[model samples]
Target: MELSPVLLYGEAEGMVRSLQSFPLRDTGSGGWLKQHEYIEKLNMQAILNASAGQEEMIKDLLVTHGKVSSLIRELITVEIWKQKVFPVISQLQDFQPRSTFPLYMVIHHEATIINLLETILYHKDVCESAEDLVLDLIDYCHRKLTLLLSRCSAGEIAGQDRLLPSSASETSSLEELKLQAESLEFDVALKCLSVLRYITDHTDSLPLSITTRLLNTHNLPCVLVELLHSCPWSRRSKGQLQKFESGRWLSVPAEDQQKMTKLDGQVWISLYNLLLRPECQQKYNIDGFTRALISSHRDPHRSAAEPSGATAISQLFVSERTGAPKEGADLRAGSRSLGLHYQREFWEMEGDSEAPGEACVLPQ
Candidate 1:
């Protein structure tokens, strides 16, 4: 039976109240399994509502309960699990399972929550509701983007051309499962890109710490310039260009080859947001390296009417090159060190807690 709006809201409320972190070892425990199932169903419903232009009660409920922080905490927790625990499990000689589906689901939990957040966080209120946890979410995005850049730089991301396996039966060996997990990681990183863009959208109203993190601590503008160069989402195979879209890659026709994909727009818009905002401009210290990076992408032929097009970016680059440094000038190197101190203090408060003692078993 289809879940009614009332039932969905009830489920959302229950999920909010029950939200808590699970240790890496207890990822597939009964309670965590139940929450995972709930998230999957809610994610579908949220997408459906978004497509149909209906009310987003799930977003409303989450905001009402002020559980956005809890949701972000869960996202970070599962990400930690994927990074720390999944590898050990993959290598365990005696850890054979009846199926790898449960393990895959645990690894997939990060993607699910991020997708749901992407759906709901389009609203300004939802962004506001994230409160202090927004800092944690920024840290998470930094980690994902940094890893993505390294993979792209080493050409590791493009080498994994295979799509995720269709079923658990196809992932028979642990090594096969490991490959699938790596593929999923690429998708998760792309999703993080969209999430980071949304966070940038709200920087005007967000705390100053957000702008500081994006500009000084993370130096995301430079990172984004590198992404534009790598173009990880678009790659060549057999001399045919393919672009990732709607969860799978499709070959680009010759006519559409020059067109910007959604990923391209995301990166450009994020740059626009970070560079054009007055507060961001004040905080962002554009040295010679950043100026050259931005100038390298300048296009004099781009239409000025286009939103966040090459023209706007080029103008910004020229201004930075000629404009005097802002008052209270401090080197980014100092800001980075200060930002690290703040990051360490923030995470130390999160504390490491263990799961309740129980046998590790597949969720059923």
Candidate 2:
């Protein structure tokens, strides 16, 4: 006998309910393998239901089952497993597996939950449901963002689509897994930014422990300042500006170059919430390093409004940050005066001819 639609929904809901109380401790390799599949299925169904505008059932299933904390634990568990277990498995001489696809799925598991959380965490209930484990989620996001920044700063990170190379024979090895992690790093960092912003939105109701972890412990405001300094989502490639969008880096035209992308907006909005929120202000330490770093990097002049001569001159002032005047002072008036003075001299000497091509570098 065929089940009615209501029965099917109930059956599906029951499965999730059973999975909710799923044991997290001492789940052996076999158990973890099974757990991986279950999480993947839940994530896939969640996405499909979300797209079909039937998110209520999935939301209730996730919250009622208390799956958020489980997801957090599982995410950290996988990360730890990757760090501790995968390397030893890679070295075992007789451990050839039939397929590396399972291993790949294990690595991709973190991304799946990240995607699901991004979809559902917008609701206040979901955020509240996370409870104290929200601190774990915050730490997880911090690690990813910090890793992204360090890689970028060290000049080790590639463009969004650039993957770590792997030969066919090396597909299932730890080396290949490392490569996959590198490839997923950019997307993961972007998702983390969104998740952090959502958490920031609900900070007023967050537990004191979560607030302490986010503000004092993590110094997320300072971390965000670093992101603004080194924007991971956009970069210069052979003089062309490429922005990460729809999974790959696409060339951005000159007109839209100055526009802030979603990644930038996410960081800035999170910063606004963290630094400006009354509760956050009391918790965060806004010391000299934070103040100077923020003041030094923020460009004051309009990108479009300024003349090329003025723009080039402004960079000199920015680069001279130490000796540069304080943040609120009117450097614009002085810089424009200096720019006009130089423009007149160049015009008088060259008779309105264009300056040398290497005269000034455009902002990337």
Candidate 3:
């Protein structure tokens, strides 16, 4: 019986060779200029191959060849360039370029590297391969998520529905390129969410510094709760449920409207891992505001049969463990059990459920 080669044959060497010439820093040198395109192509190919059930080769290329850190560095470099260089280019009078496509590519670079990272970072070894730079990545994702939260809070957020301005032109100009970057922000933020979730998934293998950064330094749970409240990916449009997917918002069918999107599931699953893990629970402070936000989202009238709701989660969890009562166990005794207290309150609250047309509320 023939078997696949152990090393993915030629692809690994080519990617490694490409990395050898890839600039550690984005200095405007001839080598960097030539290698930049090659790097982008390699990243795109990695993503494409990884998605096509050929992840091992790409994973080996990233983790074995030590490309994860390089990817992170390049990602940060592009972000710095966008912040520092792009504006200067935009503001200069004599810097008229034939096409803004090159600049758009630079802005798009961060997202591309992040896409690759997201694809591979699912593996625990890939997460560990990041080493100390994982803290840098944590900080990077924090910056993006916090910027998104600040924009959302300030009402400056671009609508998911309107990815581009009404006047975006076919021709590539600085103004149009800026619009493209702004449009990409939503996608970048979503990618950040996924990266953060992957980090949470592998907290066991990650260092304390990473955990401290996530829980204490960033207070990301609160940030995520804010995200849930804002729900930038979801909207009610003309009584239709529209959700952002594959770069645009589409109407959700009635049957699937209550189902969780990938974005929502990522947030909730991260919360579950971070909150329920023994180590994480010990470290994370479950304060009053946090408790209330969680409890408030639960409605007892909801059942596990429902598509997606916190109450459904509670019901499903209880039903799984509440199978047979212990001998001489007071069924009522279970009612006030700390574990079931929240679920019971949720039921009591549902007894006086809010009136129709009531605005959905979140805890302060």
Candidate 4:
């Protein structure tokens, strides 16, 4: 059912005003569950408005209420929950629930917020509205893309699992729920790729801190190189090639095997935005390792010919680094330390009580 206009405004206002951190132990609590339902509705409204080319009142309400930073915080909050808390709950001996729907909703909340931001952030105003929290959002995206790279490297991302159980019988065990969460994470990482690209689109207009964090602080160019090498979104199974598109993996025909998926385009576009910009080039230090990585992709002997996108990226990398400073401060270690700090902070907040019971049930 669609939300009425009056109810929509009330939900948007409540979501903005009630934004605060909820501990991992408080997952599925009454208050947190209420926010979950409200966000789900807002996500739907945002999508519908965008698809119909209508005025996005929900987006307006959110920006006008100054809730963009809150949304970013909530995104990171659930991300920490998924990384630190969900596994513990899944392994508890006495923590069985009647159904896994409520827990699934909690896990799905991260996707909802990122999805909403992806739709609205297309407008420059939303990016500006994100303000200083843009750094946190960048960190959140870095965590996801790095996870995607690691999974692809381990060959664990080749399987194409359904994000939700098709039948009631499938949700009976914690193992099945864990698998669903993994599949959902694959999609979430892909969405973050899109969000990062949008942020790259507005680098000139955004704060200098963003450009510094993406280039020097996080070294996303090397991360993206690894991603291009691993290519997580496509894999071969039983001698048939499959590529992930529109939330599912579909078999690709021989004629279309070489076509780049949207996922690939997102990576390529973000690379261009980061590597080709004059401001980013002056700040980015292209060391020997990064130079070699880019050069390898452009090698003619690697394949019969490189993709046009790869050609463009390598050209940009070569041209930008000419006569540029080779030595700069390496913040990779500092970034890792900061990540550890977040993990410790979240782990220390674990409540002694058991996980919350199902407060709001999701209809099948």
Q: What is the lDDT of residue 270 in candidate 3?
A: 64
176-284, model 2: which lDDT tens digit per residue?
Answer: 6667766765687788888998898788778878788998898887788788778878788899989887568889999878765656656655665665455775676
Candidate 3, 151-252: lDDT as tens digits: 877887454443244456554477777767887776788888889988987887678777788887887877776788787887778899888776678899
The candidate scoring highest on TM-score is: 1
What's the C-alpha lDDT at position 292 in model 3? 56
TM-score of each: 0.80, 0.73, 0.75, 0.79
Question: lDDT at 215 for candidate 3?
Answer: 83
Residue 76 of model 4, lDDT score: 87
Runs in model 4 lying further than 4 Å from the true structure: 1-25, 163-172, 298-308, 320-364
Check candidate 3 and list the clashing pairs. Answer: none
Q: Model 3 clash tally?
A: 0
Candidate 3 global Cα RMSD = 10.0
If the candidates were sorted by their TM-score against the true structure, best first, what order would they fall in?
1, 4, 3, 2
- Model 1: per-residue lDDT, tens digit, 134-198? 88888898898789889887868553655445654565667676777788788888888888888
**Taking the tens digit of each residue's C-alpha lDDT, what string does model 4 give over 1-364?**
5434434567667766766667666767998888787777788888777666668877787788777787898888888888888888788899988888888888889989999888888677789998999999999999988988877777675445774546536556677777778888888898998899879878878988999999999988778767777788888889998988878889999987866566766676567667766578678877877767765654221245523344445544564355332321122223223223322332233221322112111111
- The true-versus-predicted C-alpha distance at residue 310 of model 1, in Å, is 5.6
Ten-residue stretch with the least lDDT total in model 1: 355-364
Residue-pair clashes per prediction, in order, are: 0, 0, 0, 0
Model 1, position 356: C-alpha lDDT score: 13
User: What local lDDT score does residue 329 receive in model 4, on the 0 to 100 scale?
Assistant: 15
